[model samples]
Target: MNCEFVIKEEGHLTQSENGPEVMYKEIKTEGDDDIKSETFPAGDPLAFEDTKLEMDQREEQEDGIYIPIQCSQTGENDFTCESLNDVSNKSFTRKPSDYTHSNEKPYKCSVCNKSFTQKGSLKMHLYLHSNERPFRCPFCIKSFIQKSHLNEHLRLHNNERPFKCSFCNKSYTTKSYFNIHFRLHSNEKPYKCFVCSKSFTQKSHLNEHLRLHNNERPFRCSVCSKSFTQKSHLNEHLRLHSNEKPFKCSACNKSFTTKSYLNIHFRLHSKDKPYKCSISSKSFTKKSHLNLHLRSHNNEKPFKCSVCN
Candidate 1:
């Protein structure tokens, strides 16, 4: 004899008897497909229950299930399996606990020997060693390694001077440059030269002053092979090579390489005698003329008669 009992939505359980032994058949299905079938001896009920429990546990394990948990170090909520995988995939060979606690940097730059805790940071540092700039500006030929630096450089081409000073109506291309310019109005000289005890509003100025003490002229003229302490001086010298007079006098239509020369020319148009002799109360338009007049009062013969002397 055989008896069948339908289980909820799934296949049915069948009972069969042969002689003095009882047998049970369990069939599982999905929609119209037959999944599997198993037979359990009716005499051993405890063994059937144990087998079913183990099968349920195996199915749960096969589902690739994970629970969300808070990270012990970061205190952030993350998936248990994913966070473990992230820690395991780190470039360093140290244990996760050691990576979190230790200050030891296993990743070192081959060029500069600079050490970094993370491999990604070391990879970024390697860009500085190489001259390769993959990120190029669309407006200019300039290029940069990082996208953020390229974005900053683009502001110069766009003429985007967003930072403004409160004391003056002057604007700057960047907040850092604006802060440095503000120091001039505030009379703040934070950067001091250790050699001469001279102070400057900017660190770049102090660095340039240090070069003067060292007698280092890094900027050299390509045409004349003349060297200058400042790059601005080198740029002005280049104007002589190009014959490019940028500054022009409005009154005389005379051109000059520098604005200082144009300002001296302006005194001729305006008759502005700024330089005065303290002894004679006589004024001259040019400081050089006043200096020559002062030599007369002092009876100083700078141009000596070589044969008589």
Candidate 2:
């Protein structure tokens, strides 16, 4: 006559045939009064179908493997179905412009006040403050902050220059160096001096140029107290102080402080005259000799007679 349907803790319904018998006992507790009793027919097709569908959904969710779904907006494959569901429930997903407007930085560095949207980026930024360099080069004593940087430095020891330029076919050890070299072929000067408005291909060249404008000679010779805008100039100046002739000519046993001086000395050994006078068509080993010969064509008297004055 009367049928009472009780929902168990396992979320399953106990069934019985004929006269619609009460298969499950409703447990009476302090909070159990909220559990309303419902009456249904013994052969209710709709009730059984709805229960079966709910059980099927619960089984699918329990047995389902976590499938990652790519974020269509960001073009990143990192976003997963579980993350999407979590984000959707919280309604935290925003457009790129909204991030800039809101200035939302969820991740913050413990060491510094710097904040980032991504946790992985914040972890990477932490390396800058610490002196912990675990990734070391096998060939050299130099250690790097990142494994990728160490891998790039290893190529210098191995002489493995795989990245090549499309225009000049010039090869570089690293992709970053290769991309920088490619800019030379493209004549792309992205870095520009703020004072002079002069452009440079490399950021380092721009920084060196900025030193000239600032009159900042950071590199100084220890022996002479002579300052230089560049470190290479200071290094060359050091050789003069120490009388160190590191660049040696293979033909002769004579050594020079600089490689350019050694190259000039090499011409005396092999009669290789590279500098030529355009007017006379006469070649000379040294550029000074070629310039002296060109003075005859132009009648340029660079040397003035002080005795006559």
Q: Estimate the lDDT of model 2.
A: 0.62
Residue-level error in angstroms, candidate 1, position 47? 50
In order of appearance, the predictions have TM-scores of 0.50, 0.53
lDDT of 2 by residue, 113-137 (tens): 8996544455557778887776777
What is the lDDT for 1 in model 2?
Answer: 48
For every candidate, C-alpha RMSD to the true structure in Å: 21.4, 18.4
Consecutive 10-residue window with the lowest summed lDDT within model 2 = 58-67
Best by lDDT: 1
* Candidate 2 local Cα displacement, residue 239, angstroms: 2.5
State the lDDT at 104 in candidate 1: 65
Best by the TM-score measure: 2
The sequence of per-residue lDDT tens digits that candidate 1 reaches over residues 17-131 is 2222222222344446655545444333232321222223222112111122223344443211222343222211222222133476777899989996555456557878898
